[model samples]
Target chain A: MMTLSSLPAVSQAQAPGLPGRAGLGLKHEHFIEVLETSPDIGFFEVHAENYMVAGGPFHHYLGLIREQYPLSLHGVGLSIGGEGRLDRAHLARLSTLIERYQPHSFSEHLAWSSHGPVFLNDLLPLAYDSATLQRVCEHIDQVQSTLKRPMLLENPSTYLQFQRSTLDETDFISEIIRRTGCGLLLDVNNVYVSCINHQRDPQSYLDALPLHAVSEIHLAGFAEDTDSLGDRLLIDDHGAPIDNAVWQLYEKVLAQVGPVPTLIERDNQLPAFSVLLAEAQQAERYLAQVSP
Target chain B: MSLQDDFAAALLAPEQACPDGLFSINGADPASRFAVYRNNVHSSLINALAAAYPVTLQLVGEAFFRAMASLYVQAHPPTSPVMSEYGGALAEFIQGFEPAQSVPYLADIARLERLRVRAYHAADCQALDQQAVLLALQGQADLGTLRLQLQPSLATLNSPYAVVAVWAVHQTEGGLATLNPWHPQGALVLRQGLEVKVFAIDPGSVAFINSLAHGNALGTAVEHALEASTEFDLHQCLTLLISHNTLTHLHLEQKVSP
Candidate 1:
């Protein structure tokens, strides 16, 4: 349940997992397990905020671990689509982390996590209007300029719809990409969750997205819970393993987009490290089918 | 108001409904959908607090702690994206909470737990070497005027109730209830390497550490302790602080390090 430290270095020659497309979310639970097994995975991704500390086991472990595999730092705190301006201090901390480790790719959700000082700690959805689109693009421009790196903005899973929305979700993401020169992290589970919640066809939603701009794919488990009216609400808790429907949706995207860095994220009720690797292996299997 | 601001306000205040111009185009109720955001926000925060203060939750139990945390979150939503800094006001919230008044020591325990959380995430620092400390103080005639640079992660909290004893027993092999008499206690929280630990400290030592924590020199802090308690032991207290690696580096208030 903790990040065990032991990563020294691997051979300069690229390992089987390096430069590959299938990866597992590098959680603390699997740190020791990952080190011991050195599983044949493409890359490992981590939430940037968790490693934002100055120096400790995180940096020590991550330093050696990065040598063995490709790393992608996914951020949950950027709140790019928020109403307020981007937090400069938070941005600086992120930049520091980027400079230190220099992960292969960096990504954040197109959702707001803060209103002024209070951080809601969830990927709250935004109104897909002209104003929000412009604001998000501006924020992206600043982040890219500050970090000196192109970021992949992940699409958020929405449980509710905005009453005064003008732009379609796919159109909004496409516009953000076009305006900011940013890439997309296509989260198949989020597409499944949002589409099922709002009763849109997941295929249509996937088709509308700018698949060419996608650099990474996120597949996670969603909890099928009901809302107040008893209608199903697919909560993206990232608690369980990726489900069958989501896997099929993933395959559909892979069929079109080919292969990218794919991650399996399980944040709560974490199973054994082997279980996650098995899931990651399955994602590899799919990528192999798409490419081979 | 902007749609997001209004939406954020509604989520913060449970009584408030979905913001105006909010809808579910696919026929799902907007209110229900809004509740999803609300639940995500609250449950995530509650989980953060629980993770930071597991001992406190154990002391108060889950159901009661959840209810208390719900009220705490509503009263004080997080002001920053840093989850580590999210629940700083929880100890004070517990102090003001009427239902938790029976376990008056609960707030102090929570405060101790928060200190541990801060220590765990504090910058990794190298502790002061014992030989270096001795060499620095060897020729110094005015030792009392010497200020100490304690580890940034080192902290001391004095409570009217035995907080350290309570925190320790909960972490023991078999968790036992605190049967000790209701006496005042002091705790020294420090990070040894990456792991944060708590030590039960004598009242005089706590006074000395508190003085140093406030930027007082060695002499002044010792005098402050002596005034507070005539039985204050300076040599023993310094030994305690040194042994625990609480004092990382030493400094002279008026001049540079020796």
Candidate 2:
């Protein structure tokens, strides 16, 4: 029964926070290339669950790569918005990973992915109400306390809204941050996708969030589809290049947040490492324009 | 049911109506929008399965695999958040699955792939050096009473089908055309220097390794191997294990001197 308290304290000094430059999501295909070339990207982000295995090439490469660059661990399966109590075993595994890698930042979605023993792989949406808000805040608190560090909660790119919802998504996110004292990951692509899907202004949606608390930003691509009424529905597929509109939204975010650590996220249809590097460099150009 | 309870249920069951209280702003049907979540859940899980059992995917082709995997996902969603650990029951599911029965060896292939996945992520342990192993062998102790500890990543599979040959052919371009996949086979799967390698072994070696894995003494394991196959060669098995760096430690069981 290895509990968080039972685990030995991390003896090494904590790694520095993510630099205010562009980073790319670390992929398996690029592990050897990254080690061989040692690109000048700001940091490498990995889905925490991908490296949650006991031992393997994922750990081997991550250990070597972590020595060179700061790391950001993004979790896709924490179920932060689930109605049930948080999963202790999953939290313990996360604690172990954080101690082993000493990632500069840790983040999970504001959506839930598991229900009871069943873990749905996608980040599912939640109803934005007081009850949902309270549960999300408690989950965030539990995660933060268990990991002994603040975690960023990324806003989800949801397809539909709940009719029972009584609060705006931004208000709900703001309330959670206010209560749990957690930072915002500020996924600009999600804001654009969600706002467009719901027929809301993306800029106003961004303005509603607590931008001062944003520690990182994620920029990714989306797939467009139409709903029953022929309204444009944007899906955050992360399979294509970052959309021009999304990149424009990112520029707006950079102007406001002033060079927060940003990531060019491509989970599917991953191109060559050089292609992703080019996207990160594009973000670097935007980051450079932001005043200190 | 609660929102999540209903939501999770509907996500897996397309026949079920969309969960209540979900709406689209432009007065569009919620079911269509809800379909996105359902699609994401199924496709992402199917993709995870495809990634895990790539040879299984290639053998059955994408359409059939996705159809079969969708049923498996609905029946048994992952219990753990770790995606790599998901689909452990797929082999068992494929055994009972009627459509996959056309490919009689698919289940065994699934089993081998699962072992490879497990071996890839199993805990790391340093292999005993050649010098240490040689010293243990030459020590003035009865080799019969000595037990061998194997690496955590080591695993053995005795199958009724030529799983190793089938799996090996899929790794390359076109060896499957002239190969026989019906003969019984044994496989040894272990990670060597971060790469997981699968080797075809004799029935004797499979029994020997399984016995050792079950904590039997060297003498007892040899007996088991000989019982499984008359052609069991102790020296050959020892050489293979040693060369592959499978043995991690050797322990001697002390006997009272009479």
| Number of the predicted model whose DockQ against the real structure is largest | 2
lDDT of 2 by residue, B114-147 (tens): 9999999998889999778978898836899899
Candidate 1 lDDT tens digits, A1-292:
0011111112111111124367888886577677778888888998999887666566667887888988988899988988889999999999998888878788899999888778888999888889988999999999989988788899989887776679999999999888887878889999999998888999999889888777778999989888766777799999998989999999988788676668999899899988988998999888877664
Candidate 1 residue-wise lDDT, B39-118, digit = tens: 88888899999988888899889999998999899999988786778899999999999999988899999999999878
User: What lDDT would each prediction earn against the true structure?
Assistant: 0.83, 0.90
Could you tell me the lDDT of residue A286 within candidate 1?
Answer: 88
Q: How well is candidate 2 docked (DockQ)?
A: 0.82
lDDT of 1: 0.83
Distance from true location, Cα of B155 in model 1, Å: 0.1
Q: Evaluate candidate 1 and give its CAPRI docking class based on DockQ.
A: medium
Report the C-alpha displacement of residue B85, candidate 1, in angstroms: 0.9
Per-residue lDDT of A265 in model 1: 90
Error of 2 at A222 (Å): 0.4
True contacts kept of each: 0.69, 0.90
True contacts kept of 1: 0.69
Q: Candidate 1: TM-score?
A: 0.92
Q: Interface RMSD (C-alpha) of each candidate? A: 1.7, 0.7
